[model samples]
Target chain A: MATILKVEGLWKNFGGLTAVSDYFLELPEGEIYGLIGPNGAGKTTVFNLISGVLKPSKGRILFQGIDITWFRPDQIAALGLTRTFQNLRLFPSLTVEMNLRIAYHTHARSGFLAALLSTPSFFREEKEIGQKVDRILELFEMSDFREEIASSLPYGWQRKLDIARALVCEPQVLLLDEPSAGMNTKEAEDLAVLIRRIHEEFRLTMMVVEHRMPFVMGLASRIQVLDYGSVIAFGTPEEIRNNQKVIEAYLGVGDLIA
Target chain B: MKQGIRAEWYFLLGGLLLFGGAFLATQFLNRYLLYILVLMGIYSIATVSLNLTNGYAGLFSLGHAAFMAIGAYTSTLLTFPLALREAYELPMLPAFLGGPNFVWPFFPAICMGGVLASVAALLIGAPVLRLRGHYLSVASLGFVVIVTTLAKTMKGLTRGPMGISAIPSYTNIYWTYLWLLITVYVIWRIVNSRFGRAMMALREDETAAQVLGVYPMKYKLMSFVVGAFFAGVAGGLYAHFTKAIRPFEFSFFLTFQIVVMLILGGMGTTAGPIVGAVSLLTLRYALKPLEEHLKIYGLIEIIYAVLLIVVMLFKPEGLVGQKRGVKKITVGGKSSA
Candidate 1:
């Protein structure tokens, strides 16, 4: 498989503390790679570095063989890499339909004059965006909540909406931070299926960060285990299940590792 | 899609009714009432543009009055009759400028005012827009101080403490109303477009917007420039309407008043500033007779302060955008919820 993202010896620091250190990764195209770690193991920090939220003190990142070390977060996203936050980031006062339209603002092909004049092409393009929003809402089972304000939704639905917002951008690569963090078993299972379906349907490469062992273990074809701001082990799900270091990191140095 | 089309029709019909009503009223109203209406028109442009930057795009700026000052000076200098420039002993200017020998027509001069103010906004926003929240506010406030001080010190251009007058009073009912209509249309178009969405996204959350591929710096600066241009245009209108220009006219009080207008009306909605401006201007007129008897200055400002406090206490979202304070709407006894 061709590599879509290559991170070489990335490290990020804040003051005297090192949040993410000596992290290296390769996320291939058309694969769902998982990064599983204990709490404060720098999984999300690694995601932040990859997404350009935090500049790396050392090393570089290349997306599609182009060095993107100095790119802004928006510039990175414009190149078809998009991300979702661990905490929900919906436009609270805006309606769900408006939220989706706003998310697709970057991908819109029309200009200011086109919008101002409401020209024939503008109307055509707007109709297409509306159709796309409708289809995505339907797929996400959020069509009923389209007109409702985003903040008024139940928590579970908001999580789905966050993922839905990211999906609307049609990114080539997606970085989802803890997609199933607050879900129940059934919801998590549903999310697993949904993530798999979206991965295949959108032809996207994904790097999902999660602390839930079962969630990432079940969803990702390959998993990388992180501990103390560095990768401890990386392998398939079967290998990760039996890895001593992974078990020790998760359950501590007890009889379980033995 | 159908709903969007309906909204557009409603906006068009509403605009026609408003403009037509105002036009008819202007023909018959007394001079004082017409003056008050003109003030509202000018302020509507300023307040609405301020709303674009401070409300939708979420950049808190206190320097808009400074941009207005620059516009007032630029427009006044360009359109101030050449004969009067010589009589008033106006300072020498570059040949490209008035140069005490030439003056452009009102339209071109006013446009130049807006363009110059936009350039100033670009220069200021490029550096200061990088700062967020209160830092941005402070930097912009400093910008206002600079403009005000320059107006005081630059005796050649601004005439120092003695105000510049004999400016052609071209701002009749027609021009003010026309410019008001144009400002509303232009701002409304932008606020409803995809670019507007990108701006509001930044307002709500910058990090989220950045992650979504909305460039915060680019959109913030765009909002600032467009907003400043409209403000400058309004300042041109004010200069001609009042037939005078002074450094102290565009002071902190003016900034506070426009900010109050936006906050009282509602920020995101285009109609909010108009309603706010009209209401506040009318309130000032109503209090006009009491000002002489009270023998205190800025009694209207005191009234505005009390009113703003009351509104802020009762309705934090402003007047027009209150959705749930009453819980239900009733025509008579029947409740519509």
Candidate 2:
């Protein structure tokens, strides 16, 4: 399979502290890759770097063979890579439909003049965006909440809306930061199934940074364990589950590594 | 979609009828009332454009008065009569401009002013727009200071702040009303479109919007340039209506007043600034007679302060956008539950 996203020698520093050190990944096309680490193990930091939110102190990243290490976040997203935040980051005051439509910015071709004139082409593009938003809302089962303000939604729905917003952009590589962070076990299991369905439907390469072992383990085809800003093991879910170093890394933290 | 298109046509017809009504009123109304109406129209344009920048884009600019000054001066210089240009000892006109005995028409002069102001906005906004919040505000305020200082010291062009008078009185009620309609229509269209959505998204959360593929710099500069263009046109109208031009006329105080109008009317709503401008201008005119009778110099200013404070306390989101707020949250809450 073709490598869809590749990171090499990725390093992030905050003053004297190293948040991420020599992090690397070679995610193949259409693969669901898992990234698991303890709290502050630089998992989200890696996601940030990959998504162009944070510039790496020293490293390079390639998306579909295009170097994007120095690209701005918006530019990276326009290049067909998108991410969802661990903390929900919806446009709080806007409606759910508006939120999804806004994410279609990359796909829109109409300019200010077209919009000002209300040209037929502009209407066509807007109709296309509306259809996509409707489809995503239906898939997520949030069509009833289309006009609801994003911040006013229940917590779980907001989380679903965040994923929906990212999905609306139709990205080739999706970086999900803790998709099931605050959900119960059953909810996490449901989220895993939903994510798997999404992966199959969209045929997207995903790098999910999740804390819940069962959630990521069940969804991702391969798991990469991280500790202290570096990778400790990389293998299939079963192999990483039994890796001695990964087990020891989670030993003191009492994480479920079995 | 067809229904939406028909409704928009109806809106256009309504706007044209209102313009016709205003035109008739201008013929019969006394000079004082007409002057007040024209002034209100000019302020409406300025406030609406400012709303596009500071309200929708969330770029707190305090330099829009500088843009007005650029427009005022550009239009004034272009439309200045050849006879008066020689008499006032104005600096030589650039060769690219028409020669002696050639005076540019009013429409092109005003449009040229807007274009120049847009250029200036692009130049300054390219770098300064990257800064967010208070930094952007302060930088824009500094732009006002620079423009004012240049107007004061550029003796050859601005006559060293002695000011220019007897400018051609081409700005009648029709001209003012037409420009006001254009500004309102254009801004309304922009705010209802994709560009407007990108702006609101950026305003709510820059990071989220960025990761969603909304280029912040492009939209920020777009709003700034567009807002500056209308402000320039408004300045041109003010110059022609007043038949005078001066550097201090487009000062920080003018910017403050426009900002107040935007905040009081409702920042993001399309009709908010227009309502704010009309109400505020009417209040100023209504209080003028009382102030003269009581011999109180600053009574109007004091009242304005009190009114703004009361509005802020009661309607922090401004007056126009409040109706949806009270009902939507409850609906959202119940539905979510």
**Top-lDDT candidate index:** 2
List the DockQ of the predictions in order. Answer: 0.36, 0.45
User: Which portions of model 2 miss their true places by more than 4 Å?
Assistant: A253-258, B1-3, B323-337
Docking class for candidate 1: acceptable
Cα-based TM-score, every candidate: 0.94, 0.95
Clashes of each: 0, 0
TM-score of chain A in every predicted structure: 0.96, 0.97
Error of 1 at B218 (Å): 0.6
Cα displacement (angstroms), candidate 2, residue A103, comes to 0.3
RMSD of each: 5.1, 3.1
Runs in model 1 lying further than 4 Å from the true structure = A255-258, B1-16, B91-93, B97-100, B323-337
**lDDT for each residue of candidate 1 in A149-196, tens digit (9 for 90 to 100):** 777777667778988998888789999998876677798889888988
**Per-model fnat list:** 0.42, 0.55
Residues A1-258 of candidate 2: C-alpha lDDT, one tens digit per residue? 999999999999999999999999999999999999777788889999999999999999999999999999999999999999887788888889989989999999998898888888888888888889989998899999988888777667777899999999999999998888677677678788888989999998999988888888888889998898999899999999888888788776456535
